[model samples]
Target: MIISRACPTCRSSLKLTQKDLFDDRYGSPGKHSVFSCPKCGFGKTIPGLNRQNIGKFYARYYPLSNENPKEM
Candidate 1:
């Protein structure tokens, strides 16, 4: 099935390029999809995370400590 959405950048028709993508780095649950805008070549992720979820994901996987950034 081909799914389409409006591009967040240019408001163009975004085509579904990839689906069921998983977050292997953080082992986050749920599947995500990628959409690409043919006009602007911009890409976006479907089912974008809310503010709360974004904070959680960053805190769990990406810490802002002064430690070696490359190690992370």
Candidate 2:
């Protein structure tokens, strides 16, 4: 998970904090958040995904590749 904020202008790193929108009262609540960069004046509002996020972990994008065919 991206736990830190990044400067959109300078591509540097910044600190992050929980925004007001990040309420956990809702069961399995979404990750809607607002973050800002300390180096440059860059901020953003990110509406996070809900329960649908589980699918990403189940699908393995790349499977094991076989050794060189000629070596078999």
Q: Which ten contiguous residues of candidate 2 have the minimum total lDDT?
A: 55-64
Q: Considering summed lDDT, which 10 consecutive residues are worst modelled in model 1? A: 1-10
TM-score of model 2 vs. true structure: 0.36
Model 1 lDDT tens row, 1-72: 343488878899888899999989777778889989999999888767677788768777777676664697
Cα lDDT tens digits, model 2, 1-72, are 664355667887755544656444433444556666777757765543346854442233222354454688
TM-score of each: 0.70, 0.36
lDDT of each: 0.80, 0.53
Candidate No. with top TM-score:
1
Looking at model 2, the pairs that clash are: none
> Model 1, which residues run further than 4 Å from truth?
1-4, 64-72
Question: Candidate 2: deviation at residue 28, Å?
Answer: 18
- How many backbone clashes are present in model 2? 0
